[model samples]
Target: MRIGMIGCGVISQQYLASFDQLPDVQLVAVADLDPARAAAAAEGREGVRALSVDELIADPAVDTILNLTIPAAHADVDLRAIAAGKNVYSEKPFAVTTKEGAEVLVAALAAGVLVGSAPDTVLGTGTQTARAAIDEGLIGSPIAATATMVTPGHERWHPQPDFYYTPGGGPLLDMGPYYLHALVTLLGPVASVIGAASRTRDVRTIGSGPRAGESIPVSTDTHVTGVLVHESGVLSTLVMSFDAVATSAHPIEIHGTEGTLAVPDPNRFSGDVTVHRLGGEGWEPVPTAGGYEEAGRGIGLHDMAVRGPELRASGELGQHALEVMNAVLESAHSGARIEIASHVARPEAVALEDVRAAT
Candidate 1:
């Protein structure tokens, strides 16, 4: 599959690094609102052209669009790519709103194009190994889960951190995708959500980059906590915060009738998956049993190329996750439980294999 990458920002570098490792996909073109950024990405690569966003989307040689644009532009870019008769794989959060996310899916279906989304990190060894252990009954009948992500703030490091404080870029919307997607992958679709949120300050001072010493206003919640009641009757508790410094808690922990499983960070591609049995003394490492070994960002696009419509990191799942998150925020302010209108079947498990073998 020939890919046309539409954003040349921080995350694009990760995808570019993995393109050579993925045998099923190749980068042919790149685009950005800034022509200089696009040119920089295409510089050292062969057979890659820097083009305007419209020209790249309409290019006949490009079969798929790898959308790395910001949250607000995700749906718009995807719709345009679908109109151009190309598949689309976008970054996390799907879109700023569920209504927009649904529009992208409806249009893609009508156009006979595939729509995929990120946080495919779940397809990596960390989450997949934990999944295999659960399926193997190491955790017995799954009962509940807890997912936690916390950081003091992103302004300390990110060059341009204004978006992190905006409405579509809160802790829940910004960092929730990785944890929520992983939870759904381990548990199932969320049936209902109840949430409570808080923000510490109205203005944040940038600590790094050219924007250092600049103050950005915070218009969104910085600390978010919620309960996701899965359709399978499993209860997954979530805590995502930009207000806290750090925590010793595992990124995710699943408890069952017989034991508990500690899952690695879903934002990453690989880590140690450990299990503590009911009769066991200490946490034992679960052997790597599934997913793409040594994979990275573009592995999801590679999976899309090989599996076509059955791609696991699907927009359906992304949309469901987005809806769940938006509902959580709504519930936070409304003081009521919100029911999810969208659902997605659990993706097929990927058998463990070399990254290049996906071809």
Candidate 2:
């Protein structure tokens, strides 16, 4: 899968670093709204070229478009790539809204191209280890879980934090996908959600970059709390916050009849996954039993290239996660339990192994 990477930004650096080791995928070209930025990305690379978005999409050597555009442009870029007969793999918060996300899927289906999404971090050992425990029946029958993410705000470090406060951005919409994706990966699809949300301030002062001390409008909820009722009857409680300074909570925890598993951050590639059983005195570590052992961001594209329709980090999963996040916000405003209209099968578990293709 030769790739044309779109968007040259902070997140793109991670994917750039990752592409070097993924044997099944190659970075053939790159593009961004800013031509200068695109050129800079291609500068030291021997075979990679910087092209306009239009040129990259039409480039015969580029069979896949790695979309790293902002949330608002995800669907548009995806639809464009699909139109040009290219497979697309996007960064998360798949799109600003479920309607937009769904449209990306529909177009891909009609175009006969594959669509994939990020937070492929879950395809690493951290969450996958937790999953292996569950599948091994160490956690017994799953019952409930909690996923938490908290921060004062992204303005403290991000050079450009304006997008994080707008409608398409928020604690739930921006940071929710990681936790939601992990939950779905562990528990299966959700059936409904009950939500409540709040915001601490109407304006935020950017703390870094050229825009330091500049105030940006906050149009979305800064803190969101919700209960996702998985179709399997596992209830996952979620608390995502931009208003909080810190917390002692684990990134996630799964409770079942026999034990409770402390899952590492789903946003990372690997961590110690531990479990405490019914009569245990302390938590014990679970060995890594799945995912790309030393993998990084672009590993999902590798997965897509090899797995075809069974791609784990699928566009359908991205859309389902987007719908779940949006439904929670709708429930927050309406004070009603919102039922999810779309359903996706839980992606097949990653086998415990290294990602290197067989020699």
Candidate 3:
């Protein structure tokens, strides 16, 4: 897979670093709204060059587009790449709206091109190991889960945090994908959702960078809590907040009739998975049993590269997660439980392996 990365922002750095380990992927070109940024990213990288967004999208050498653009541009970039008969892998939230996300999927299907999305973090050992235990019935008869993420705000660390407060941004849309994707992997697709949300202020003061002390407008919910009723009859409680200070809660926890599983954060590639059996003394660590060892961001591209349309981090899953999220927000506003119209098969469990060797 020859990749033309369409954004050179902070998130792009992780993907760039991931490329060296992903033998199945070749980042042939990079583009950013800021030409200097794009050029800098390509510098000293053998055979890689910087091009305008247009040039990169049209470049025949690039068969796949790594759409690292902001949430607002996700659908547009994907549509363009699909129109050009190229596969696309986008960042989280898929698109700003459910309609745009659906359109991107329909276009990809019509064009016979592939689409994948972020939060592939679940394909790593951390989440995958827990998934393995669940499948093996270590935690028999899965019943419920709780996922929680809280922060003062991204404005404290991110140099450019404006997008974190916009329409397509916010705690649920920005950070929810990681938790949502993991829940789907551990449980299954959501059947319906009920939600409530709150925003503390209308603006945020940037804490660092050249724009430090600058205030940005807030146009979305900062704290979002919801209950996702999975198709498997499991209930997962989700709390995503940017307004809070901190917490001691595990990132996620899965409960079952026999036992419970402690899942690590889904934002990264790996972590320890612990479980307590029906009569166990305490929570015991589960040995890593599945997923790519020492994996990173672009592993999804490698998965897509090898699996083609059967890739685990698929656009269909992304869109389903997206709809589940938007419906939560809609439920928040309407004070009603929203039924999800879309459903996606749970992604296949990853067998324990080294990604570098697979390529």
Report the lDDT tens digits of candidate 1 across residue range 159-259.
88888899789888898999988888888789999999999999999999998999999999999999999999999999999999999999999999999
lDDT of each: 0.93, 0.92, 0.95
Point out where model 3 deviates above 4 Å: none
lDDT of 3 by residue, 1-359 (tens): 99999999999899888899897789999999999999999999999999999999999999999999999999999999999999999999899999999999999999999999998999999999999999999999999999999999999999999999998899999999999999999998999999999999998999999999999999999999999999999999999999999989889999999999999999988999999888989989999999999999999999999999999999999999999999999999999999999989999999999988855
- Residue-pair clashes per prediction, in order, are 0, 0, 0
TM per candidate comes to: 0.99, 0.98, 0.99
Local lDDT at 84 for model 1: 95
Give lDDT tens digits, candidate 2, residues 115-227: 99987988999988888899999989999999999999999999899899987799888889899899999999999999999998999999999989999889999999999
Best-to-worst ranking by TM-score? 3, 1, 2
| Regions of candidate 2 where Cα sits further than 4 Å from its true position | 357-359
Indicate the worst ten consecutive residues by lDDT in candidate 2: 350-359
Spell out the clash pairs found in candidate 2.
Answer: none
